[model samples]
Target chain A: MNIEMIRAAQARLEGHARRTPLLNSPFLDEIAGRRVWVKPECLQHTGSFKFRGGWSAVSGLDPEARARGVIAFSSGNHAQGVALAASRHGVRSIIVMPSDAPQSKIDNTRALGAEVVLFDRAKDDRNAICARLSEEHGLTLIVPYDNPLVIAGQGTCGLEIAEQASAEGITKADVLVCCGGGGFTAGVALALEADAPCLRARPVEPEDFDDMARSLASGVIERNSRLSGSLCDAIITPQPGNLTFPIVSRLAGPGLVVTEDEALHAMAHAFSRLKLVAEPGGAVALAAALFHADEIEGEDVIVTISGGNVDADVFRMALDKFGG
Target chain B: MNIEMIRAAQARLEGHARRTPLLNSPFLDEIAGRRVWVKPECLQHTGSFKFRGGWSAVSGLDPEARARGVIAFSSGNHAQGVALAASRHGVRSIIVMPSDAPQSKIDNTRALGAEVVLFDRAKDDRNAICARLSEEHGLTLIVPYDNPLVIAGQGTCGLEIAEQASAEGITKADVLVCCGGGGFTAGVALALEADAPCLRARPVEPEDFDDMARSLASGVIERNSRLSGSLCDAIITPQPGNLTFPIVSRLAGPGLVVTEDEALHAMAHAFSRLKLVAEPGGAVALAAALFHADEIEGEDVIVTISGGNVDADVFRMALDKFGG
Candidate 1:
């Protein structure tokens, strides 16, 4: 992808994407044995970093295409992001979601003015339905991860981080971001590596998946199907996207995998100390920083808290696990 | 008592207190039938507006007094606030808390490096304990609300709201603040009324402790012993304070009372829609705005979310009430 395209996307998303606070936590700093800064995208509109790409992709369409509207397939944050973004721009949005998607996400998407079409993952194909909807309605398909415009939108989060850290006199740090299909981490790495040359970007994953880590070691993109039974549903994708894999390969400095227990612990920590309602995926980077403190000790670190859209049941489960 | 003293306290707290976000909620606006802005002090360090006063009071002590340390009595946010604030200033703090105070607050104060001295409210006099501790340790007593320094610190929150609203092109609005002992509301009123002459400041109370409302109607301070069995522990005080009453009387426009159900519903709404963890007391103002939509229709309004120190058990109970 052209770097200038990403910059243009950032420009288009300037006022739309929230310039979320880069909060400092002395307790977290102590826990990580490093100076810790959190970029709270969890506080972003639609409760996630998905809004960056959702707004970017939707807003970049030509007026005629925008008139036709947009469609996306997701069971989580991206659905709400697209719905909210499309509504904000006065365009219709159609979200194709799995039947088992959390009720909260479904309600939130519909509340944001989206037409939600549910398909059973056990009995039907979500991608095929989304494709059919896009074609039938003449709606532009805005893929959550594979699209270039989406990656560019996600990169705006990194731009904000670099600007905030620089303003606070922080010139160098290790940045940890949670990875699923790598859209968020890829975008963050590209922006941080380009603007803050001294900073190192590490993409973290659930130990169950770790496809990016495997792919990085093998010098080629690889797919894994062992991503199951994890508390972090949002980052349980089986493989990194083709478009994002290359960007991740070029920009990410290292790869780390954390246990599900670590993610739950981190989520609890965030709720108790920071008073933030971070979803499991959003807490993964901070979890890695805290659980693997020795590796990043004494370093200035920035963790991206990517979303705050956990299902009530999932949150309750996490609370129970952590003895809240 | 001196205006310059408040200015001096502000200067002392320049870099300490967080300039918390003033979030504009389109969802809340639609629900409240008005333009609503949330001043989220719940996101402040120690998860409350009390931190502003705590930090300011702790940091303002002379070197000799700082060396001697400080003492305070609180069962909730104020306890954590003083503990965290004193820790930030490297001053030792002793907190006299009710033994029945939530474990989260107790644990948090201990985590912040304060000595926790638990007392049974029914059997022990907390004030006597604090006095004895202060005398024994040569520590300065930091009263939570009655002190001028603490009031000045609390006023800084109002100062920030005024600046944030002005920056957002909101020249004036009716500001609703939840009242405990009246420090927070009085401080907010003072700052907003002084800085934005057209802004109206109103105090909100839980139906059980409608002391501010009764006082306003009677044109004199009134004390009540009736305690409403409600979830908002932070603002369930029996009456307004001597120091805070005069300030509140001079600056506040009117007082509003809201039901316990309204407070709980607001807490759930904030959590689900805004993704904010607001304690019940902190949400009471928003609750009034939400439940009393007709009273505030078509008006520009701002509500203060005073804290986010709700216990996990309390949160679960409230969520159950809201059918979560």
Candidate 2:
């Protein structure tokens, strides 16, 4: 929660994470009624922003902890991020993924040299399995969101955006980020507040998991259905993390909810218009901007396109739904 | 046509044209029956390698010629590339595009501050319009290909690939490039010959306009029908350029022809597995590698993914065709 810690993390991650291009989309600019800048983390190594956090966390660990390696529980982008980062650092990685996770995700993790243990989300507890693995192997548990280092690491993205925007003569932004455990949004808010103080940060979520939005309005943590099948598989968690919720509650702006259809439409639009392959979760923030254009009229906006790791079959289904 | 001139062009375009990433794909490597390295010009500015030629041609012009502006005629990626490069150089650009050009491309060109003059490709002479514009406005005609400067510019891509492959312990490559006016293939061949003497370059074309293949086999220039309504819109020209043909004849090893279905499948595979957006013409070389794996067996291979500028409707059709 320390702003200096976030700044230090940004300094630590300089040159390590790609300074992903802030691509201009005149097509999106025309449609949005304002200039739109896309921070394409989808082009990041491991095909997601999660790599930033994973790399930061792993690299910042004490030598003893680093020697023990890392463990993470995720079914998608984070799994790849940790696996790739750990492999790059010559550290072993153990990933606990749901049994129903897409074959592509599992395969990518394995390709990155991670040891994947599949758990049935419907019948077993992922966290318990992850804990067991961490304990058994004496590995450091690298939680996907709740850890302080992870949040600070994710903040580097916002730092880059602020620097890039300033260089482009942009002093303010209505920043939209897709929210799951609130880790990404909280980290981004902290960085924006520290750097581009005038910028506003908002978290966008699927209608099915509107807990973050509900929590923001009530100023309290909230939980949603544990079994909702949201279009954004990456952000379909039931609740925001405890550590993230506090930082988000104190620093984050209001949250917006977009329907599954809107997310699909945004994904198709991004793929065709911007020539970017944004996964459903990554497209959610842009979907909110598009679906609620009237609300954001005349504002200079920056949308964090989070990842590009969707299964081919799921990508086709989304494209079909959006008539692309 | 001079190899040294092409090398000079590569030097001039060093920092201007992106040394686009030469991505390694394990899946593609497995399918290619060799180590597969992809030169992703599809990720270049304006989403194609044409930007290289456009930049080189415009930058090499005398100051007075540059001040007078430039003009081109095209129905696809070339229009946007010229427009964007001209805008970057603070020069006026007039594009004589066919009325049937994809609306998205036309709009993109206009957005880059180019003057778009539309003519019916079937009923009117596009060259005549371009000539008249040049005469009236004193504009420099920047031919898309069939010009020495343009060929030199496109050669930079091949130079980058050869250097990058060498860095990765690959000294030789069976390079596959999609051919249109033979500009890209010729440029690539010149660069490969200069940088990696052991490398062999092959141009791949749609079966409908297999002039390059026939000409290479028969040792004579051959003309074919101007292919129309093909998925590979970017490379449907009737023949290789007069300047480029001789370079290809002297440097290229062979030519390959791919089916329309194979190109679409490659596009989809790029989208799904490689996380790249590849137009049909851009995917043709990859299609040849995938479909003709037996022919290219055990060879270190590099495919130039030329562009990523497909219409939304056409992309959807390709997705469906590939079961994406």
Candidate 3:
């Protein structure tokens, strides 16, 4: 929650986490009608920004706690992030994943030497299962968001963006980030508030799954009802986290939402022009930058591609549907 | 090209070109059975290593020479690189391109403010046409790879790899470079010889168009008889350049050739794992690194993804054919 903690998290994750590049595309700039700088977390360790938080949380633990290991519940970028971070420290990790989660995420988490407990999303409660496992094993629970340590870890991304943007002579800009449970968005908001006040951080989400956007607007935590099936499965968390909601609501500006079609188009553009593989969830901010350009008031805009671990079939479909 | 000229080129291209990241993948390392590092020039300005040569040549010109502008013949990465570099310098660039070249390349070159003169590759001598244009317009002729300034510009890639590898505690490495006219490979060879003698540079080429491989072995320039049908069209130069061959022959080790399938697989791996787009020609070195691991002898292996300017259809086929 503080800049010092974020700096500490950055130091803890240094050399382990990749400082993902700040990319610029003239093509995207043309579409956005301003300079567009992209922070591609798709290139991060474990193919997402989750690695920064995972490493920060895992590495920040006391040696005794680290030896006892950790447990968490997630089936997306967070699973692989925590798994990789735990393995790096020679600590055991157990990820409670949905039974029908993408095979790649499960396999990758296992490959990182983490034990995966599969539960049916329709029939079983992942949180209850994770709680039982954590208590039974006397393991620390590393929350996907909400946890101060995890938020501090995610805040490093904001710090990096500020430093890199400053280096590129970007003193002030409109920065758009993809929001899932508001973990990264809140962290980025806090970091920007401390380090680079010039960068106005906003959360972008899928049309139907705009929990964080609604939360910021209504001045309370919000939840998404099953209205429409979304392609951005990586970020379909039902509600904003208790801890993350306050940070985003207090520190961040307004949020934006983009359609599934727009996200797919952004994915295709990333493939063709930016030369980056972005999952649907990761492409939301880009969708906003490209499709809702007129609403973005700034000299420059920074969009974050949050992850790149989509199913092969899904990627092929995006390329087929929207690619030139 | 000498080290001094390369240093000068680096100085000239300080903020003009991107210092592309050298990426490592555990998945690639597991397949290669050794540590493998990749320098992705696909992230370079104009989407390829050609920009280095292009910028180096354009920026190296005297002020009056720059005023008359420059001309070159190529319908690939070079065309866009030259066009962009010339535009940056506020100079006129006339690109003599093949009529059948990819539309994306033509559009990009023209978008960068170059005047395009399309000619039949099968019927007209592109060099003759370029020469006539240069004479008529009093424009400086920028050879794609043969010029020392261009080669020196390309050598900056080698300098960066050495510096980055040394930072990672890599002392000795086997570097595989994609070869067309051997500008990049030869420049890399010279730069490595000067700064990082511990790293050995090797040339990689498409299977049938293995002119650099043959030239390295025979002590004479060997030409590929036919090239129109090759998938690696960006790098299908008939033979090694006169200026480049000698440097590569003198400093670099044996050359390697990869099949079109292998290059496509490399492109897919770059897409799926490294999260970078790589053209077929750009992916050849990666193919050599991944598939020809047994032949490489060093503490670590390094491969360069030289470009990312393939047509959408070509890229889609690469993803479908080889992606996970």
Question: Which candidate number maximizes lDDT?
Answer: 3
Which pairs clash (backbone N, Cα, C closer than 3 Å) in model 3? none
Rank ordering of all candidates by DockQ, starting from the highest: 3, 1, 2
Per-model DockQ against the true two-chain complex: 0.51, 0.41, 0.66
Give Cα distance to truth, residue A297, candidate 2, Å.
Answer: 8.9
Per-model CA lDDT versus the true structure = 0.83, 0.83, 0.89
- TM-score to native of every candidate shown: 0.93, 0.86, 0.98
Question: Which stretches in model 3 have alpha-carbon errors above 4 Å?
Answer: none
**Residue by residue across A1-324, what tens digits does model 3's lDDT show?**
677889899889788888887988777888888999999999888889998999999999999999999998888889989998998899999999989877877887898779999999789987889889888887899989888899998889999999899999998888899999888998898889988999988999999899888988889888899733788988888799998888888887799999998999999988877788899999999999999988788889899999998766777788778887
The better candidate by TM-score, 1 or 2, is 1
Deviating ranges (above 4 Å) for candidate 2: A1-19, A57-69, A87-92, A166-169, A190-201, A225-227, A249-252, A289-300, A321-324, B1-19, B63-68, B87-92, B107-112, B159-171, B189-201, B289-300
**Best TM-score goes to which candidate?**
3
Tens digits of per-residue lDDT, candidate 1, A164-238, equal 889778878888888889988888888887788777778888786888878877868888777567777777786
Fnat for each predicted structure, in order: 0.38, 0.44, 0.52
Residue A22 CA error for candidate 1 (Å)?
A: 2.1
lDDT of 3: 0.89
Better of 1 and 3 by DockQ: 3
- Candidate 2: the clashing residue pairs are none
Kindly report the docking quality category of candidate 3. medium
